[model samples]
Target: EDQVTQSPEALRLQEGESSSLNCSYTVSGLRGLFWYRQDPGKGPEFLFTLYSAGEEKEKERLKATLTKKESFLHITAPKPEDSATYLCAVRGSYNTDKLIFGTGTRLQVFP
Candidate 1:
Protein backbone atom coordinates (compact mmCIF):
# COMPACT_ATOMS: atom_id res chain seq x y z
CA GLU A 1 0.00 0.00 0.00
CA ASP A 2 1.17 3.51 -0.77
CA GLN A 3 0.93 6.07 2.03
CA VAL A 4 2.21 9.40 3.27
CA THR A 5 2.45 10.58 6.90
CA GLN A 6 3.37 13.95 8.30
CA SER A 7 4.55 14.58 11.83
CA PRO A 8 3.43 17.12 14.44
CA GLU A 9 -0.13 17.71 13.37
CA ALA A 10 0.29 21.32 14.46
CA LEU A 11 3.23 23.58 15.18
CA ARG A 12 3.48 26.92 16.95
CA LEU A 13 6.34 29.18 16.10
CA GLN A 14 7.40 32.69 17.00
CA GLU A 15 8.03 35.13 14.21
CA GLY A 16 11.49 34.66 12.72
CA GLU A 17 11.73 31.16 14.16
CA SER A 18 13.03 28.45 11.86
CA SER A 19 12.11 24.80 11.84
CA SER A 20 11.76 21.73 9.70
CA LEU A 21 8.75 19.43 9.32
CA ASN A 22 8.95 15.76 8.38
CA CYS A 23 7.06 13.88 5.72
CA SER A 24 7.47 10.12 5.70
CA TYR A 25 6.18 7.72 3.09
CA THR A 26 5.93 4.14 2.00
CA VAL A 27 5.07 3.54 -1.62
CA SER A 28 5.61 1.26 -4.53
CA GLY A 29 7.84 2.98 -7.06
CA LEU A 30 7.52 6.66 -6.28
CA ARG A 31 6.91 8.72 -9.40
CA GLY A 32 6.93 12.06 -7.66
CA LEU A 33 6.66 13.86 -4.34
CA PHE A 34 4.42 16.89 -4.13
CA TRP A 35 4.19 19.63 -1.53
CA TYR A 36 1.26 21.98 -1.06
CA ARG A 37 0.20 24.73 1.27
CA GLN A 38 -3.44 25.20 2.15
CA ASP A 39 -5.08 28.01 4.03
CA PRO A 40 -8.36 27.82 5.92
CA GLY A 41 -11.25 26.78 3.67
CA LYS A 42 -9.23 26.94 0.49
CA GLY A 43 -7.60 24.57 -1.94
CA PRO A 44 -3.98 23.60 -1.70
CA GLU A 45 -1.42 25.70 -3.49
CA PHE A 46 1.43 23.84 -5.17
CA LEU A 47 4.79 24.30 -3.58
CA PHE A 48 7.34 21.84 -4.90
CA THR A 49 7.93 18.58 -6.67
CA LEU A 50 10.73 16.12 -6.06
CA TYR A 51 11.31 13.39 -8.59
CA SER A 52 14.43 11.75 -7.26
CA ALA A 53 16.72 11.40 -4.32
CA GLY A 54 18.93 14.33 -3.37
CA GLU A 55 16.71 16.72 -5.26
CA GLU A 56 15.64 19.92 -3.51
CA LYS A 57 13.34 22.88 -4.20
CA GLU A 58 12.76 26.16 -2.43
CA LYS A 59 10.61 29.25 -2.33
CA GLU A 60 10.77 32.28 -0.13
CA ARG A 61 11.24 30.82 3.36
CA LEU A 62 10.40 27.26 2.44
CA LYS A 63 12.66 24.46 1.22
CA ALA A 64 11.86 20.89 0.25
CA THR A 65 14.09 17.89 -0.16
CA LEU A 66 13.53 14.29 -1.12
CA THR A 67 15.20 10.95 -0.49
CA LYS A 68 14.64 7.31 -1.31
CA LYS A 69 12.07 6.84 1.44
CA GLU A 70 10.99 10.25 2.66
CA SER A 71 10.82 14.00 2.11
CA PHE A 72 11.11 17.10 4.25
CA LEU A 73 9.77 20.65 4.26
CA HIS A 74 11.87 23.24 6.02
CA ILE A 75 10.59 26.63 7.07
CA THR A 76 12.88 29.52 7.82
CA ALA A 77 12.13 32.81 9.54
CA PRO A 78 8.43 32.19 9.62
CA LYS A 79 5.94 35.03 9.88
CA PRO A 80 2.34 35.24 11.13
CA GLU A 81 1.02 35.23 7.61
CA ASP A 82 2.84 32.03 6.92
CA SER A 83 0.51 30.11 9.18
CA ALA A 84 -1.23 27.41 7.22
CA THR A 85 -1.50 23.70 6.68
CA TYR A 86 1.21 22.04 4.68
CA LEU A 87 0.29 18.91 2.84
CA CYS A 88 2.34 16.23 1.14
CA ALA A 89 1.35 13.85 -1.57
CA VAL A 90 2.97 11.04 -3.48
CA ARG A 91 2.43 9.79 -6.99
CA GLY A 92 3.10 6.11 -7.37
CA SER A 93 3.71 4.02 -10.42
CA TYR A 94 0.59 2.00 -9.72
CA ASN A 95 -1.73 4.95 -9.29
CA THR A 96 -2.88 7.44 -11.90
CA ASP A 97 -4.09 10.88 -10.77
CA LYS A 98 -4.62 9.32 -7.39
CA LEU A 99 -2.29 11.16 -5.12
CA ILE A 100 -1.76 9.59 -1.73
CA PHE A 101 -1.96 12.44 0.75
CA GLY A 102 -0.83 12.94 4.30
CA THR A 103 -2.96 14.41 7.06
CA GLY A 104 -0.89 17.59 6.89
CA THR A 105 1.11 19.70 9.30
CA ARG A 106 -0.57 22.82 10.58
CA LEU A 107 1.79 25.67 11.27
CA GLN A 108 0.94 28.67 13.45
CA VAL A 109 3.34 31.53 13.29
CA PHE A 110 2.85 34.03 16.06
CA PRO A 111 3.90 37.60 15.48
Candidate 2:
Protein backbone atom coordinates (compact mmCIF):
# COMPACT_ATOMS: atom_id res chain seq x y z
CA GLU A 1 0.00 0.00 0.00
CA ASP A 2 1.40 3.36 -1.04
CA GLN A 3 0.90 6.17 1.43
CA VAL A 4 2.19 9.61 2.30
CA THR A 5 2.55 11.05 5.79
CA GLN A 6 3.33 14.58 6.92
CA SER A 7 4.59 15.37 10.36
CA PRO A 8 3.77 17.98 12.99
CA GLU A 9 0.18 18.50 11.85
CA ALA A 10 0.81 22.23 12.48
CA LEU A 11 3.66 24.64 13.02
CA ARG A 12 3.94 28.19 14.37
CA LEU A 13 6.99 30.34 13.75
CA GLN A 14 7.92 33.93 14.46
CA GLU A 15 8.76 36.29 11.65
CA GLY A 16 12.32 35.78 10.34
CA GLU A 17 12.42 32.31 11.80
CA SER A 18 13.29 29.30 9.70
CA SER A 19 12.10 25.71 9.74
CA SER A 20 11.51 22.60 7.70
CA LEU A 21 8.47 20.40 7.00
CA ASN A 22 8.64 16.68 6.50
CA CYS A 23 6.83 14.36 4.11
CA SER A 24 7.44 10.64 4.12
CA TYR A 25 6.14 8.08 1.68
CA THR A 26 6.08 4.40 0.88
CA VAL A 27 5.24 3.32 -2.63
CA SER A 28 6.10 0.77 -5.27
CA GLY A 29 8.34 2.19 -8.00
CA LEU A 30 8.37 5.84 -7.04
CA ARG A 31 7.86 8.29 -9.85
CA GLY A 32 7.71 11.83 -8.51
CA LEU A 33 7.06 13.88 -5.44
CA PHE A 34 5.31 17.25 -5.46
CA TRP A 35 5.00 20.11 -3.07
CA TYR A 36 2.22 22.67 -2.75
CA ARG A 37 1.05 25.56 -0.67
CA GLN A 38 -2.56 26.37 0.13
CA ASP A 39 -4.21 29.25 1.83
CA PRO A 40 -7.30 29.01 3.96
CA GLY A 41 -9.93 28.92 1.23
CA LYS A 42 -8.01 28.35 -1.98
CA GLY A 43 -6.75 25.35 -3.85
CA PRO A 44 -3.17 24.27 -3.41
CA GLU A 45 -0.57 26.26 -5.29
CA PHE A 46 2.09 24.15 -6.98
CA LEU A 47 5.54 24.56 -5.55
CA PHE A 48 7.98 21.90 -6.75
CA THR A 49 8.44 18.49 -8.30
CA LEU A 50 11.28 16.16 -7.44
CA TYR A 51 11.87 13.21 -9.71
CA SER A 52 14.57 11.33 -7.85
CA ALA A 53 16.60 11.11 -4.73
CA GLY A 54 18.95 14.02 -4.05
CA GLU A 55 16.82 16.28 -6.27
CA GLU A 56 16.08 19.77 -5.01
CA LYS A 57 14.22 22.92 -6.02
CA GLU A 58 13.99 26.37 -4.56
CA LYS A 59 11.84 29.49 -4.77
CA GLU A 60 12.24 32.59 -2.68
CA ARG A 61 12.51 31.45 0.93
CA LEU A 62 11.46 27.88 0.27
CA LYS A 63 13.69 24.97 -0.72
CA ALA A 64 12.48 21.42 -1.34
CA THR A 65 14.64 18.34 -1.29
CA LEU A 66 13.92 14.70 -1.93
CA THR A 67 15.44 11.49 -0.62
CA LYS A 68 14.65 7.84 -1.18
CA LYS A 69 11.95 7.71 1.47
CA GLU A 70 11.11 11.30 2.34
CA SER A 71 11.13 14.95 1.28
CA PHE A 72 11.60 18.18 3.10
CA LEU A 73 10.48 21.76 2.58
CA HIS A 74 12.95 24.18 4.10
CA ILE A 75 11.91 27.74 4.79
CA THR A 76 14.55 30.35 5.31
CA ALA A 77 13.67 33.42 7.32
CA PRO A 78 9.96 33.22 6.70
CA LYS A 79 7.60 36.16 7.09
CA PRO A 80 3.96 36.44 7.98
CA GLU A 81 3.08 36.27 4.32
CA ASP A 82 4.59 32.81 4.21
CA SER A 83 2.00 31.38 6.50
CA ALA A 84 -0.04 28.69 4.80
CA THR A 85 -0.78 24.97 4.66
CA TYR A 86 2.02 23.05 3.03
CA LEU A 87 1.00 19.93 1.14
CA CYS A 88 2.92 16.95 -0.17
CA ALA A 89 1.88 14.49 -2.83
CA VAL A 90 3.47 11.67 -4.74
CA ARG A 91 2.77 9.84 -7.99
CA GLY A 92 3.70 6.21 -8.41
CA SER A 93 4.90 4.58 -11.60
CA TYR A 94 1.82 2.36 -11.62
CA ASN A 95 -0.53 5.30 -12.05
CA THR A 96 -0.10 8.28 -14.33
CA ASP A 97 -2.78 10.58 -12.93
CA LYS A 98 -3.22 9.20 -9.47
CA LEU A 99 -1.56 11.03 -6.58
CA ILE A 100 -1.32 10.12 -2.91
CA PHE A 101 -1.45 13.19 -0.70
CA GLY A 102 -0.62 13.88 2.89
CA THR A 103 -2.90 15.63 5.35
CA GLY A 104 -0.63 18.71 5.21
CA THR A 105 1.05 20.83 7.84
CA ARG A 106 -0.54 24.16 8.67
CA LEU A 107 2.12 26.79 9.20
CA GLN A 108 1.66 30.16 10.89
CA VAL A 109 4.35 32.79 10.74
CA PHE A 110 3.63 35.60 13.16
CA PRO A 111 5.31 38.91 13.63
Candidate 3:
Protein backbone atom coordinates (compact mmCIF):
# COMPACT_ATOMS: atom_id res chain seq x y z
CA GLU A 1 0.00 0.00 0.00
CA ASP A 2 1.04 3.59 -0.54
CA GLN A 3 2.13 5.38 2.59
CA VAL A 4 2.38 9.02 3.59
CA THR A 5 2.91 10.44 7.05
CA GLN A 6 3.13 13.91 8.56
CA SER A 7 4.51 14.78 11.95
CA PRO A 8 3.11 17.09 14.62
CA GLU A 9 -0.51 16.68 13.61
CA ALA A 10 -1.17 20.20 14.88
CA LEU A 11 0.89 23.26 15.67
CA ARG A 12 0.15 26.60 17.32
CA LEU A 13 2.43 29.57 16.85
CA GLN A 14 2.50 33.16 17.91
CA GLU A 15 2.52 35.67 15.12
CA GLY A 16 5.96 35.89 13.51
CA GLU A 17 6.98 32.49 14.82
CA SER A 18 8.86 30.32 12.40
CA SER A 19 8.64 26.54 12.14
CA SER A 20 9.02 23.57 9.89
CA LEU A 21 6.62 20.80 8.94
CA ASN A 22 7.65 17.36 7.88
CA CYS A 23 6.25 14.87 5.40
CA SER A 24 7.56 11.38 4.96
CA TYR A 25 6.65 8.63 2.56
CA THR A 26 7.49 5.16 1.39
CA VAL A 27 6.37 4.58 -2.13
CA SER A 28 7.74 2.91 -5.21
CA GLY A 29 8.65 4.88 -8.29
CA LEU A 30 8.13 8.31 -6.83
CA ARG A 31 7.24 10.63 -9.66
CA GLY A 32 6.81 13.91 -7.81
CA LEU A 33 6.18 15.51 -4.46
CA PHE A 34 3.68 18.30 -4.04
CA TRP A 35 2.97 20.83 -1.31
CA TYR A 36 -0.24 22.74 -0.77
CA ARG A 37 -1.94 25.08 1.69
CA GLN A 38 -5.56 24.48 2.53
CA ASP A 39 -7.70 26.96 4.37
CA PRO A 40 -10.70 25.90 6.38
CA GLY A 41 -13.50 24.62 4.16
CA LYS A 42 -11.54 25.46 1.05
CA GLY A 43 -9.67 23.41 -1.50
CA PRO A 44 -5.92 23.21 -1.32
CA GLU A 45 -3.84 25.85 -3.04
CA PHE A 46 -0.79 24.47 -4.74
CA LEU A 47 2.47 25.76 -3.37
CA PHE A 48 5.39 23.93 -4.91
CA THR A 49 6.47 20.78 -6.68
CA LEU A 50 9.70 18.94 -6.16
CA TYR A 51 10.43 16.53 -8.95
CA SER A 52 13.54 15.03 -7.46
CA ALA A 53 15.76 14.84 -4.47
CA GLY A 54 17.80 17.96 -3.73
CA GLU A 55 15.25 20.17 -5.39
CA GLU A 56 13.81 23.14 -3.47
CA LYS A 57 11.24 25.83 -4.07
CA GLU A 58 10.24 28.98 -2.24
CA LYS A 59 7.49 31.55 -2.22
CA GLU A 60 6.71 34.39 0.09
CA ARG A 61 7.19 33.14 3.64
CA LEU A 62 7.36 29.50 2.66
CA LYS A 63 10.07 27.23 1.33
CA ALA A 64 9.81 23.56 0.37
CA THR A 65 12.63 21.12 0.07
CA LEU A 66 12.69 17.46 -0.80
CA THR A 67 14.92 14.51 -0.14
CA LYS A 68 14.86 10.93 -1.31
CA LYS A 69 12.51 9.81 1.43
CA GLU A 70 10.89 12.91 2.90
CA SER A 71 10.17 16.59 2.46
CA PHE A 72 10.04 19.68 4.63
CA LEU A 73 8.01 22.88 4.52
CA HIS A 74 9.66 25.82 6.21
CA ILE A 75 7.68 28.80 7.35
CA THR A 76 9.61 31.96 7.92
CA ALA A 77 8.14 34.32 10.47
CA PRO A 78 4.64 33.53 9.42
CA LYS A 79 1.70 35.83 10.11
CA PRO A 80 -1.81 35.14 11.29
CA GLU A 81 -2.94 35.02 7.71
CA ASP A 82 -0.72 32.02 7.19
CA SER A 83 -2.75 29.81 9.50
CA ALA A 84 -3.93 26.82 7.49
CA THR A 85 -3.60 23.11 6.98
CA TYR A 86 -0.55 22.17 4.96
CA LEU A 87 -0.85 19.12 2.77
CA CYS A 88 1.76 16.87 1.24
CA ALA A 89 1.20 14.41 -1.56
CA VAL A 90 3.22 12.22 -3.80
CA ARG A 91 2.58 10.86 -7.23
CA GLY A 92 3.97 7.43 -7.44
CA SER A 93 3.27 6.24 -10.92
CA TYR A 94 2.98 7.57 -14.43
CA ASN A 95 -0.07 5.55 -15.39
CA THR A 96 -2.67 7.89 -13.91
CA ASP A 97 -0.80 10.49 -11.88
CA LYS A 98 -2.78 9.72 -8.76
CA LEU A 99 -1.67 11.41 -5.57
CA ILE A 100 -1.51 9.71 -2.20
CA PHE A 101 -1.87 12.40 0.44
CA GLY A 102 -0.78 12.61 4.03
CA THR A 103 -3.23 13.51 6.80
CA GLY A 104 -1.90 17.05 6.65
CA THR A 105 -0.34 19.31 9.27
CA ARG A 106 -2.63 21.83 10.94
CA LEU A 107 -0.94 25.17 11.65
CA GLN A 108 -2.47 28.01 13.61
CA VAL A 109 -0.74 31.37 13.80
CA PHE A 110 -2.13 33.63 16.49
CA PRO A 111 -1.99 37.36 16.62
Worst 10 residues of 1 by lDDT: 91-100
Alpha-carbon local distance difference test for all models: 0.94, 0.95, 0.93
What is candidate 1's CA lDDT for residue 32?
91
Clashing pairs in model 2?
none
Per-residue C-alpha lDDT of model 2 across residues 9-79, encoded as one tens digit per residue: 99999999899999999988788899999999999999999998999999999999999999999999999
lDDT of residue 75 for candidate 1 = 95
TM-score per candidate, chains pooled: 0.96, 0.97, 0.95
Candidate number with the higher lDDT (1 or 2): 2
Q: Write the per-residue lDDT of candidate 3 for residues 52-103, one digit (tens) a residue.
A: 8999999999999999899999999999999999999998665767899999
Query: If candidate 2 were superposed on the true structure by all CA atoms, what would the RMSD be?
Result: 0.8
Please, what's the RMSD in Å of model 3? Answer: 1.0
Where does candidate 3 clash, by residue pair?
Answer: none
What is the C-alpha local distance difference test score of candidate 2? 0.95
How far residue 98's Cα lies from its native spot in candidate 2, in Å, is 0.5
Per-candidate count of clashing residue pairs (backbone under 3 Å)? 0, 0, 0
Q: Which residues of candidate 2, in runs, are more than 4 Å off? A: none
